[model samples]
Target: LAPMLERTTSAVVNISTTGKVVVRDPFFNDPLFRRFFDVPRQRRERRISGLGSGVIFDADDGYIVTNSHVIDKAEDIVVTLENGQRFDATVIGKDPGADIAVIQVEADNLTEIPLGDSDDLRQGDFVVAIGNPFGLGQTVTSGIVSALGRSGLGIESYEDFIQTDASINPGNSGGALVNLRGELIGINTAIYGSGGNIGIGFAIPVNMAKQITAQLLEHGEVRRGRLGFVVQDLTPELAEAFGVAHKKGVVVARVEAKSPAQKAGVRVGDIIVSVNGREVENSAQVRNEIGLLRVGAQVQIEVLRNGKTRTLTASVGKQLKQTVSGKSLSDKLAGAKLSEAPEDPSRGTAAGIQVVKVEGRAASAGIRKGDIIISVNRKRVKTVSDMKAAIKKNPKTLLLNIQRQRQGLFILIR
Candidate 1:
């Protein structure tokens, strides 16, 4: 282990970032008080700093991979090698939805870690996590893979995590999880406990990170594609009703008109078994499989329908952006421009309408820009049309379930 780590530790780098954040003050927000006191309206800014770890995956190109949150909003970034050499870094690209980022530094004689197949990993496999925990410089902790394909943690928009019992803590974000041979298998990202490790840590599988890194390097962003359908987990009751032998798949709930799935003959009541030859146990797996593919890529889908199995080939399509005026939906929602929220394939369904612009009655009702309308009058809405129909049914009273950042709130307008 010592010999292997000696060769591997050089590829793991310590990262530090500097940025600025606005300091909000209610006293400074009052127009009347500001006018009377003749005070300047410029907001206060505070310098901020963050620390984390990164892996030097492409040594020749000076490319490093790390967690997006580590470098998010950073104005300046610096990377320190194990030998005490430091180099300034620049962002190549970042995928916030997946919590993966690629940054580069111009340096010479760098060592790159060999990538391993995370799909080959299994429970109880010996693995080691290397990172700068709590800014204490490079540290290594050994553990076993506790679980695979872990999701629904709400940590990131897309989650197919590799769970381990390693000692991953603060400043370990974007570190490397390697096998016994020193091959990089995952990127350490999150912990299960409150600000500490509790024998449960999550890492982004290296396979998924590789896919995201390729897109970020080429396009500077990940352009996730969609299959043009919504699906729910296949319950035991539904599985029995559909004559399925096992309740391990997802049931097709809705298919968008003229979508690639529709064009490929996918329909409601179809039980999706797999995507591109990979078996999907749930909707999130299906979404993750399809979402990772590039737009226009051809995908083979297997479904069970009418107690028979069939395969369909479809092209992945780019997500559509549709917007509508608030007034068109309802008078109470006036002065707001709503659009379909960006699809999170990990969520396995369309989220809700986003308030892109808010003012007037919508603003007065406590709606703000960037707020997501999860439901209206207790009815779930995924698109502008859905919201319009929901508003029509409720007419007088408007009850909205909104997702504002990381919090959920309800607003009522009568």
Candidate 2:
């Protein structure tokens, strides 16, 4: 263990970041109160700093992999090697949905860790976690893989995690989880407890990280594609009813018109046994597999239809995120940018317009980014067209029903 640590620790680097965040006050934002008190109209900002860890996986190209959260909104990033050498780092790319980011530094004689196949990992496999916990510098902790294919933790948009009992804590994010052979198998990410290790930690499997890193390096963002089909988990009762021998699969609930799935002959009640030759057990796994694929990529989907196994080939389609300027729709909505909400297969297409940006009149009317406009003037609006029609019906008053995170509110613009 000591020999392996001696070789691998050099590849694990400490990451620190500095950025600024706006500090907003309701009283300061009020124009009437500001005028009455003669308060300055300038927004306030405060400097912020953060600490984390990273792995130098590509020494030749100087590419380092870390969690996106570690470098989110960072104005300046610094990487410190185990030998006390520091270098300024620049962002190559990031995927917030997957929580993986790649940074690069121009330096010489950097050691790179060997990549291991995380697909080969199993439950109870001996593994080691190396990171800078609590900004305490390099630290190594040993534990066995507690579980594999862990999901539904709501940690990330893609939730296939490698669960371990290793002692991962604050500042350990973006570190390396290695097998006994000193091969990198996972990226240390989240823990079960609140800002502390509670014998339950999760890491992004190396295979998934590798896939995301390749996309980020090539495109600077994860361009997720979709098959345009809805699916549900295959239950034992459904399997019995469908006369399928295996219950571990997903059932196609709906296939969108003119979609890739429909073109490939995917139908409702079809049991999706595998995607691109990899067997799937639930809807999330299917979603993850398809979401990681690039647009125009061909996929082989095997389905169990009417007790007969059939394979279909389909091309992945680019997910459409339509955006429109608020001024195009209504004058009261000026200075806001609206886009179609992300689609959720389980809930079909999302029925609202997401406020991607807000300023001026829209911001003054209490509109904000990330707020979903579910209705306008008491009429439901799902898309830009729907919103346009709703606003046209009632041009005098703009009544917006907004869904902000877990809360709902109403804002009027006149």
Candidate 3:
């Protein structure tokens, strides 16, 4: 254990961050009332600090990996090496949805930790965690791999966590989770043990971290393709309704007209079993798999429709940029361009017109620039003509079915 610690500890660094937080007085909201009552409207700013740990993966390049939440809203960051050498650091890239970040510092002769394949790990494997637990300096804890592929815990938008019984605490975020050979297999991220290590801690698999970090290094932000369809998990009831033997794949609820999925011949009621040859069990898995691929990349999608499994290839497209501007449309839409909705509807690609612009009454009513107006007054509208016909009825309250980013919701336009 001592020899293993000696080899890996040098690559682990302690991170400290500081920033300013602004606080406004409650009376600031009602200045007139405050003046009438002789109350002071004041604002205050205070300095906040944070501490965490990071691993030096590329010593020669001074590349380090850590948790995004550790440095979030931090104005100044400092990295301290095992030998007590401290240097200022800058953020290279970050994905908040994944809770992972890459930072760089100007240093020389740093020791780098060997990265191991997380997929090679199995249950009952011996693993060690090294981190600055609770800010009590560098600490080490031994544990076994309790589980793998833990997801849907609401920890992050993308979750493929490694569960362990390691002693991870508040300052342990972004620490190193290593195997018997002292190779990094995961990055310590979150703990479900309340305020301390209650024999349950989670880490982001090194495989996922490596992919996200590389993208961040190249683009400074992760860009994902929009499939132009909505899907739901294959529930047992849905399986019965779809006449399938078992609930094994995700069901395509709707496909955006003229979108990539439609162009690839994807349709409603298709049970998607795999993407790019990788089997997907749920909607989130499909999203994550497809999202990792770059725009314009062609992927093969396999689906079960009408009791037949077929594969279709699609060229991924970029997500529509969300801006409050676009070409003008008819008066009924209130100056917004009513076009085909781009992404998912809450109800999985409901028939609707996408609002490319938000002007006039629609803008005033909180109708965002990219909102997809799926229906009006319980009438489904797939195009500008359909919307016009629906508006001609002059319903007292226009109940609109809007799809934004594939989630369905009803918005009332009165």
Best by TM-score: 2
Order the candidates by TM-score, highest first — what do you get?
A: 2, 1, 3
What are the models' TM-scores? 0.85, 0.87, 0.76
lDDT of 3 by residue, 1-414 (tens): 889889999999999999986555555535467656875546578899999999999999999999999998799999999999999999998988788999999999999999999989999999999999888888899999999888666567677889999878899999999998999999999999478889999999999888898899999988877778888889899999999985678999778788899999999999999998878877767877777788999999999999999999999999764432222333434646556643332124454676754544565445765467877778878766676677668745567788665567887765
Per-candidate clashes, comma-separated: 0, 0, 4
Cα lDDT tens digits for candidate 2, 1-414: 999998899999999999997656677767678767987655668899999999999999999999999999899999999999999999999998889999999999999999999999989999999999999999999999999988756577687899999899999999999999999999999999686999999999999999999999998999999888888889899898888888789999878899999998999999999999999988878988999999999999999998899999999998877779998999888889999874454323345898877876688788987688989999988888899899999898999998775468999887
The per-prediction CA RMSD against the true structure, in angstroms, equals: 4.6, 3.3, 7.0
The worst-scoring run of ten residues by lDDT in candidate 3 lies at 323-332
Give the alpha-carbon lDDT of every model: 0.90, 0.90, 0.82
- Model 1, span 102-174: residue lDDT tens: 9999999999999999999999999999999999999999999999999867787678999999889999999
